[model samples]
Target: METILFFIIVGIISTIFGKSKRTQGQSPKKPIKVSGMEDIRTLFKELKNEVSLPAAPIKSEQKVEVLQKSNRTLEQEYNQVRKESESSRKALAASRLQREKMKEQTIEVSKDECEPSISMEPNAQTLVNGIIWAEILGEPRSKKPYFPKRG
Candidate 1:
């Protein structure tokens, strides 16, 4: 708003001076002098300085090439990470299979160990018969009761 006011004031002053100068019979080729000459000059100088200053710098080709290289490296890293995860998954599956096989072997060994022996010893029957006969006879009448051992 202030810049617009300055331009309007300068324009009004220049027009009034221009009309007065025309009445003086002065040469029309000469530049018209106004009371606000210094302000206008300063405004033009500031505008020239702003125009001379560079705007945003343009991106060079080298910067774009560097970004492309970094993108490729990132892609390689992503593929490596994927491969590592897949290998670890396979290793876990193999270990699980091995654990299951170990469990099956352990179960088989335990079953074998738990089975009772089927072979009989010759004295097992004789010992059983003697215990039965002795219980039937009650207490022996004599201290030395003879009992024959049979094969």
Candidate 2:
């Protein structure tokens, strides 16, 4: 039993020391070179070329001419709008003046029509006669009294 226990302990210590020596004696693994690196670099170069390429350039004179044409058109449009606004304003003022004239004419015509004419005759004479007739005859049996019609 004692010899068996001593052998077991010696075996465990020998395994631990053997593993340390094996690890220390071995060399570290070198990094593997990838074959696809050249393809990636070429693709990056193509992207850089496409990005760095310049667009077709415009001449300074052509740019100036384009700007001048646009400015002229804008000025013409502004003038057209200004003329239209001025004409509309004139039409509005004319219409307002005509409306005021019509209003004044209507006021004058109404004054002439509404004025009471001076006359020596009394307008209530017929009413007084109607009252006298009603008192003499009292109320008639009909809805309307039998009074003589006058034009």
Candidate 3:
């Protein structure tokens, strides 16, 4: 382990010294040449003239046509969405009315069934009362008294 560590330290030192020697022995490089102010001014003038040429008018006309087409499509989409929402609203109202009618019918049916029970004859009422008591007491029907068979 000690031998391996010694070789690693030696290798790092040799690389560091080698890079410093190579940089110190090299000559400095010359500065790069650049264009003067007149050349820059002429280039800027050419660019400005190209930007202000006939192609600008054609681009503006095309932009206008594109904007009109997009506006028409947006208007059509808005009208379609409005129609769909109106239809959904009508459907919702119809379902609400149907639910209310169903509730009224159920109420009427329950009331009719209750009226018959209230107006039942004495013998039938007594038999019903006995059956209800037997159910409450958990009595089996086989142990109950037999009734006359109905025609």
Over the stretch 1-151, how does candidate 1's per-residue lDDT look in tens digits? 9999999999999999989988899777878778579889999999998888756654788679989999999999999999999999999999999999999999999999999655566487877976999887877656555874566
Ranking by lDDT: 1, 2, 3
* Regions more than 4 Å wrong, model 2: 1-55, 121-151
lDDT of each: 0.88, 0.87, 0.85
**Pick by lDDT: 1 or 3, better one:** 1
Ten residues in sequence with the least summed lDDT for candidate 3: 26-35
TM-score of each: 0.41, 0.45, 0.43
The model with the greater TM-score, 1 or 2, is: 2
Give the local distance difference test score of model 3: 0.85
Give the top-scoring candidate (TM-score). Answer: 2
**Tens-place lDDT digits, model 3, residues 1-151:** 9999999999999999988987887534644336656788889999999987855466778889999999999999999999999999999999999999999999999899888554455787688988988888887766675985678
Residue 1, model 3: lDDT of: 100
Clash totals, every prediction: 0, 0, 0
